[model samples]
Target: MKNKVLLLTWSALITVVLLASLSFARQGTGLIGNVFSDFNDFSWQLDEFYDIVGPTKLNSIDVEEAKKNITVSDDEIERHRYRYGTLADQLSNIHDQYAQRIADAKDAGNELLMNTLIEERDMKLADIRKNFESDAHVEAKIRKEKEKALVQYLNDVKANSFSLPVAYEFTDVETGETYSSGDVSVPAVYKKQFNAAKGYFKANSLPGHNGTNGWIRTSDYGNQAASEDIQITTSVKTFEGTVIVPKSAVAKGGVLYSQYKDFNKGRLATYVFWLLGIIALITLLTVMKFQKEWVTGTAIADWYADLKIDLKAAAFFMTALILVGYIDSKSSNLSNFFTYQSLGRWGEWLTSFLIGGVVMTTLFAFQLVNGVERWKREGVLAKDIKNSFTLQFFKALREMFLKRSIGVQSFILLIGFFLAGIGFIGGFIDGIFLMIYAFCVLFLGLPALYIFVRRSAYLNRIIVATEQMASGRLNEDIKIEGRSPLADHAKNLNNLREGVRISMTEQAKSERLKTELITNVSHDLRTPLTSIITYTDLLKDENITSEERAKYVDILDKKSQRLKTLIEDLFEVSKMASGNLELNKQRVDLTQLLQQALAEHANQISESGLDFRTTIPEEMLIAHVDGQRWWRVLDNLIVNAVKYSLPGTRVYVTLRKVGDSAEFVVKNITKFELSENVDELFERFKRADTSRHTDGSGLGLAIAQSIVDMHQGNMKIELDGDLFKVTVTVPTK
Candidate 1:
């Protein structure tokens, strides 16, 4: 905060200094312009260069009388006398010269010569003492002085005295032909008038009647030179320092230019400098505020957009500048004010600092209020510049271009044809303008329309593909062209189509399996139910033997038990598949659970005459799981192995901890040929043997897989020809 304040102070000071400099510049007061004056003073050889306008009025003077009018202090008079000979010494030299001439003339001359010398000496003495001279001599000296003034004035006019340019124009009174001064020429026909004016001038040198009309300008472009003189006058309001209003008796034709109006350039310059300083200070303040917005962590373009400073304010400034220029043109008084007036020197120095300080302080104060408002508004982005251009063109292109709208885009192209027609028709009337119009239509209009049309066509391809996809037509993928956004969209669309096709195929396969499951389930139920019904009907015969009745009863019990087991297995599998089974999860010893399951199946193992191979780990393999559901997985695997294993064949069972999981493996020789599609065993009502020879529902493996899934474990059935293997893994953590 302290640094920022300090920086603000410094900036204000700097701006003030710059503003003062600018004000001085506007006043035409500058250091470099005085370099020549300084050099002239320092140089040993004095410059005698002087500028004068032609036909200047020279002052008439009597030398002795002028000397008496002069006043000076004795000290200054002594200083001037030491540097140059005084009037006293000049008078003394003149007196001595006359006295010597009188003596010499009397000694060497005859009476006629001495008489002439005596009269000439007395006359010279009277002329010097009383300032008396012949009328012819006085007139001659005045004329000579006037000639010198006239020459100096003319030289001043040639070099544009006081750095003022005087533009000249001449109009022939008889022909009404106005000519640029650079384009006019003196013609032969004017020689008569020139001589007549000269004669008139010699007749009377007092100068009132000594004037003649003359051509003012010369030309070299053609032979259209002036053959006669013309009466001309300057129409502009100003001359260098004086204005010569023709009707005001200030200037006469070919006579003398007299001062009409005079204005001090230094006084006029003051108004100009003030106006410039005021304006510059305001502009500086505005610009400073615009820049300060960026210092408070906001991006520059964003702040510009937020404030509208650049877009609106800059345009206003340009318009104001142009307006001021036009206004200045209509008012010469205001123009003179800018051209001449200024504060001398000290005020210029002070104004610089004042301009800076005032501008900076004003801007700083504005930011204090406006900066808080910036927080409430979201800033603009770099992308907004592009968007701004797009919006600017939206009116022209809105009806057709953009948005992949092919119809609208093509319509614009159609309109372009008519625009082109108008352009061509316009061309014959005016080549330059119409040709420009034609190019605008052909290049700008046609190209813009075509660009949108091309984009629309690109977009249509995607639309067509999307429609086909909605209609369940996912055959061919859409093709892409170019490295534009549409190409990327096309690629994604193609991928979507492929994914939908695969999903449909998978759905169809699942439907077929569901249908097969219903048919197999019915068959399995009918087989067990038939046995129970038939056995119960046979047991109803009164004449049947006890042994026969007992055998039928045993068959009934066996089929009924098999049907119950199948129904239970189907229900469990369905529950797991539907995700409705609630689990009582707890830390259970997987090894102990495996041992208990083996003990429950020991009778079946012993009766089957199968050699049981067990590889149970001694350490507890603990995992958070439903103990009953996990045991069921083990039971199904053991039962599946026992039912499918060949009689008297070796049955192998292994259980161990594998990394973070508890794994169980069961292997046996298949009683029937096992198919290569072993994964089908996990499907409901599916088995290795198609015939219902085995006293087991095919739901065992499916139920085991479901229970394993419920426990978030992995179960797989592996088959190597007649060898069957099932592996189950459950996470221990």
Candidate 2:
């Protein structure tokens, strides 16, 4: 506890000292800049006094000297002659300038102003007509007008008092013209000590004159001219001047130089002291003990970090406002510290407010440092804002807008309620109005309430159906009633339920196939083994004849060959099922391959007592497939037909181009019933010879389908009672 207290104290001390240092640097001089700038406030006051007084003093002499050269030039007369253009243009300009004013005066019942404006327009028009073409007349008029304006300017300057606590003397360098005012004999030592004014001549002392002189045109024309209606030229006079600040003026204490000297004392020393104090405090705070305890994070930091982002931002804004107040007060005080100026009643209140603000800002600064350290260790502002309620609410709004129907409906409902609230506000006027509002609510609100309740119940139904589906009860589907959003949701739920049903059925079928697979494999292997074992026992009896031994041995050899064929076929089918079988695919003429398969089985087809009806295409139907695998496919289909077809029944083999595919179809009347599902015939070890009388391994169709599928083609079986058909379709291109 003691460490935390000391840490906070040291932190607050550092904040106060640092802020004070900044305030002084800003209001006085900067840390590494001119030390004399600490007295800039007094310097500014001195400069302001000189600026306001110097121009007034200089203008009097400048105007007096300029009035001597108030002569009009030929160019000035010509410009003034064409100032308003032709006679017609002059009349139009006059009308445009005063037409509205005259109308306004007449409307306001000011007949004097109306008549005066009319007279003035007439005078200007008459002047333009009389002097429009006479250059000499215009020049005479311009000179008279300039002299008249110069007299008026001199009179105005005389009326205004431009008193100063100094004396000035000027002498023209080229003409030796003297212009002096007040005491010109003041001591030269006092002039040098005070730096009262520049003694050298400035080229451009008059307004609007650079280093050259020109005719001073009036503002009526767009030339930059003299001010105050004083029409005169600068006349190119260079004057050397000296302003003398007397010791009497300096001793008076209210003059600018006196005020500056009085106020400038101890300003630099104050700044240096403040800078050293801040540096010392910074060093002390840096090496302070237990800094990690409170400078890292404290209870206040935890409280701030736990605040909502909006609240934290608001606190930071308030802290900023307080910091601004502190800086303003500190600067205001430091800038006037030596001036001894009082702000009257407001100053006390402001000082108290600023003290409180300073304390608050210092504490905020301490907490801000600690909070920043804590936030860096945890995460930045993005992490906090991500978990903020404002972001979450906006995220929800964004998701709602993804489905525009729901968003629009929700907005409409909100607007309806908001307008309804406004309508209810009128119910406060009278009790009868309240009763009317109640009736209106019942009339409109009932139907809306019914819709809300119905949708809620429908949503509940969908939820219940999803729950049942999750628990593996997919028999029931959601009942869709309307075309609303809720109804659409119910339809999707029903579709999902159907998909789950199909998946469950396929799973059961797979289980059944697995069981049948084991049974068939065991029976098939055991029968061959039994035959081999029985025949071997007969051969072992030496009493048997050679013909009997040879016959038993032949039986054994046939059984072993059957077992080997079964094992090999099983392994190949397994490889195909597990996707481990690789095919060597190439472009081959499928028509020739089909004919070759039939040629290979020609003897079997002839001996089976089956009538073979072949419809092989003479043209080549090319396809990309593994030739060896594709031949196996055709061989299996043909062999199956020959083995299973009833005696003397006709077998059909057809190969033709069908659309984008090359289709090979074989049809036969089966000796046994194909009552099983057509799709189940594609399962391994499943055959039409359920009694196990034939040597058929039941993998023929399965292997054919796997090979076709590997080539990105199709194999399908169609059964019509005892008539079975198998079709293989592969892409021709």
Candidate 3:
């Protein structure tokens, strides 16, 4: 499960990376500007051609005329300097007036006035500078200063320019007859000048009128202009057929020179080859990984099942990936093979498949070996290889596919594939680093989460079971089974449950046996003691006995009878508790039982000088219970009430049907401080009163409790101030 989860996580990570990389790779860098700038050699060549070829002719004419005209003297030089200084001062004074007017307008918050003044100032200043610089000798000096600027502008133009050989068709404005540029020929001088300018204009296809009538002149046509009405047609040509020219020859339609079609084609081929090589390497690695079988000392059948599942999953995943790639390639304009995007997608899918398969296979193998060994001693496997393979295959398939063994296996495969794909895509060192990082996070974090959840649930179940056991409800079954650690813990919990049940059962049995032994011994002793007490009483009552003899005999008879009754009660209590004595249940009247018990204790109650009262409904209160046992219950309560009641205090017995049960309650006011713990009085051999006035056994209430339990009724004792109460509730028919 851990490996499976890891595989899934790894697969997801690889998928994300694959998508991200493809997205990044598709966006070409904006480095064309930098490349153009860096190749300054191209710019310089163009600059030199324009300056030496075009501007040289104009400069020569000016220089030759200057040489024929005159020589400069000191006076002329001084005069020229004075004129230049005067023009500069006048220009500065005009700028001050403009600046003052603009500042004042801005301070007054008059934006309109400020803008107007600034525009007026700029126009006046330009007029003044132009007038000053346009002088013949001044222009000569300016031209010298503008040389570098001219070269730089020309370089910018050349470097920024590109042109395609479009199939041009020109239509005559007058005749509408189309003529191809290839078919037309004009003079070399006209062609050279026209073509240079036309080439430059066409290369830098600006979206504006280049001349009058909205028609641009070509470098091959010199100053000739075509009317806008004379439409020119053009079409795109493949790079293979497009002509390339030298930087110098490019200005005009001179012979085409430099060509890069073959070079670009070769470069593309190299790229494709390299891409295929990488893909092949990845494919080979994946195949090897898939072929490598994992050996786990688990049951062969289980391993086979797991292996079958992993393989099918892998195959399905790969098929899906391939299908998607094929569909995308067919539907889109993207290349069908060797694209960065396609490769990444394939890598991610392959990674997932390989990782899932490997992990599942490994786990399956382990489980299979284990299972096989477990069954080996039982002769589960045949020694024949053919039979083994057949068994293993079917078993493998069932476990792997039917049982969804793919869960853990898929996770493992995903993780492995993600790491491997990451490594493959990233290249050796970087890929390895990424793979390691991914593996650690997936293998560690996911498994930890699973274990945490599993253990938490397991602990919760255990706690609940423990609480039930603590509450004396030990008959609960805890059964947990799985490959998870929590499952093992659940087994332990189950064992603990059984242990607790066994201990409780044994303890209950021992208590029952002890109760039985005591009951039997006490009964045997009580019978003999009862006879002795009866004989002693009979003798004491005889008229022939002397006064001392009668008194001693009466004392002896009282003590003997007390002992006998105590013994009998103890025996009866034990018999009832241990389930050794069967009850003859019948429909007994609860009201009658209470009345009889109260009447039997009436003499004692009256002797004690306590008011005895009975409240029983006249209606028939029927309940299923042993009449003899119920009588005992009522007798014990009445006796207890009589003994505990204070002299002149009232003792009350109430019997009635309350809801679904018949309720019997005996309440009496006690002379002594009522015992703080009433439950203790229900124990065998226990007594509420230390005085021996009551010739009663403490086992009386205990026996009553046993009888009530046998009838599935509830008995309780309560004390309020000097009032002591015993209540019994039995189900009524």
Q: What local distance difference test score does each model get?
A: 0.58, 0.71, 0.54
Off by over 4 Å in 3: 1-545, 691-693
Record all residue pairs in model 2 with backbone atoms less than 3 Å apart, i.e. clashing.
none
Looking at model 2, which ten-residue stretch has the lowest summed lDDT?
187-196
- What tens-digit string does per-residue lDDT give for candidate 3 at 203-291? 11112222222122222222122111112121111111112222333233432222222223323543454354355446535642321
Model 3: lDDT equals: 0.54
Please identify model 2 stretches exceeding 4 Å from their true place: 1-16, 23-164, 168-171, 175-190, 193-199, 203-232, 235-242, 252-303, 310-314, 317-333, 343-360, 366-370, 373-383, 393-397, 404-733
Counting clashing residue pairs in each candidate, in order, gives 20, 0, 34
Each candidate structure's TM-score, on Cα atoms with residue i matched to residue i, is 0.37, 0.38, 0.31
Q: Score residue 282 of candidate 1 by CA lDDT.
A: 75
The candidate 3 region of ten consecutive residues with least summed lDDT is 234-243
lDDT of candidate 2 at residue 196, scale 0 to 100: 24
The RMSD of every model to the true structure, in order and in angstroms, is: 31.5, 26.9, 29.7
lDDT of 3 at 547: 68
